[model samples]
Target: MREVAAAAGVSRQTVSRVLNDHPSIRPDTRERVLAAMAELNFRPNRAARMLTTARSRTIGVLAASASSLFGPASSLDAVENAAREAGYFVTVAHVSGPEVAAVEAALDHLMAQAVEGIVVIAPQQRVQDAMAAVSLQVPSVTLHGAGLAGDDGVFVDQVEGARLATRHLLATGHRRIAHLCGPGDWSETRARRDGFLEEIAAGGEDVTGIVSREGDWTAESGAAIGAELLADPELTAIFSSNDQMALGVLHAAREAGRRVPEDLAVVGFDDIPEAAYFAPPLTTVKQDFAELGRRCVARLVERIEGVGAVGGGGGAGSATGSATDSAAAPVPPQLVVRASA
Candidate 1:
């Protein structure tokens, strides 16, 4: 600022006013400041600006990816776009494990950077529980979180989504079914599995012959579990908690000499980009994960700007199992019909 003011033959205050676009600055004076800034290759100091304006204009993301899953990865990308569009920069710290120490360390890393707000996104219940024990000092949003204190959440209705898939299969007269669930620690794994069982009970289907298998949310795990489940010829359908595992089921069925929707049916969650191009396109539940991330950032900004009530701040207790109860609207899931089912 000093160099620019000196080159422009104006006071530092005049240069500051020009930088902030104050309307009172004369046109010629503004032009001179711009020319001086260009000549000196001057860049505004973000730290100094924050000191003067009390705004960092930057948010932090603490994202977890237990296995490089599609949901967390997609959310990070969407958050970057949304924050940039809202005129803020973003910093990210990834939580590679479900341990409380990992989460706390990541939080500390972000907080030390002077971020004005934070976004916490982890799919595993254990991780969310871990986050609940730590106190956050800034406004925050959680995605698929346990609704830790001082944080609002944004999520898709995972249980209803699973029910949608299961309901569709039962409505089509397929009674003997299997459920390929994700890792036991993940919140999604529990919600989706419950939905499958609930819908099956609602349809009055006998549970004796149904197959339930747990996978590590990878295609290889899916194929392994699916192969054994497919050994039973009575199992006419399978509903996977995620699309990757669904792909593995398709592979297993193919190797087992079964034609999808002809000999057996399949349904999956999270309609990833490649679902439509599978050997036989997958029928799966679609969550607008990108939109979910965008809305989360928007809501966090509201809290950061002090526009509304914040969750559990100032030592208020925490809450969990947030569905439609969060400050932000829940993103509904849609079932897309394709040849697989």
Candidate 2:
């Protein structure tokens, strides 16, 4: 510290402020100090600082889905980047399933590492319940879970996304719309299913016998279900919970000798990058997973820094309230239309 301070021609206090990202430091002075540190190869002792400040400057991430999933993987990357910018390290624990025991084990691992807070990416209701059951001393936030009252979390509005897809089909004059949903245990599935139903009702369509099927959020499962759904000739359009399922519906449509948008229009959610490049160019809803990650870290850090209340309360942290507050509206999803629908 002394060598860098001398090199930068600044006092030790100014150097410290610059290192801590204090807003009071002048930009020129901050740049000079950073240049001096770079030249001197000065590396701050994180362990010694933790002892002095009683803060590990580390955040934990517990994800129920594998990193390969497009939404979860993108979210995880965003969290890591945001944490790094905020001068904090991240530790990840990927649970194999949403089972209570699995979640508990993942939490235990993160606790052992002494992380300052935790961010759970929960897609399933079971995972959300498990998180509620645990008594956490550290500040925690859930990503993608239903923002029930009294829960600290941030989520993409799955219902709104579903509504967008369904409305698009309706606007295209397709009344006999079918729905392909994910597992019933998932909060997203329920929200999307309800959204589809709500839209159908609002449109005054006679959906007395509309078809609905459940899939495992895999292209293969989608394909299998799609094949079965194609058996019904009355189904003029399909709203899939995700883009992968829409791809399956396309495959089934092809095998059944039905042309897209001519015989059966298909809409999907979560417009993954490849959605635009599909054979028929799928129309899907786009959720900002990266923004969700950034918000999750921001909320968690606010609670850790004592600027925000934990769970169910409002705080002056960022534009978005504390993670646990039900009042905070989730980031909305948008629809990207293409040839398929």
Candidate 1 lDDT score at position 274: 96
Q: How far is candidate 1 from the true structure (C-alpha RMSD, Å)?
A: 5.3
Q: Write one digit per residue (lDDT tens) for candidate 1, span 182-225.
A: 88877778878887888888887364226466798889998999
Best TM-score among the predictions, by candidate number: 2
Clash pairs, candidate 2, are: 151-324, 152-323, 152-324, 153-323
RMSD values, in order shown: 5.3, 3.6
Tens-place lDDT per residue, model 2, 20-72, is 88999999999999999999999989887788666789999998876777778
Worst lDDT 10-window in candidate 1: 315-324
Could you tell me the TM-score of candidate 2?
0.89
Q: Please give the range of 10 consecutive residues that has the lowest summed lDDT in model 2.
A: 310-319
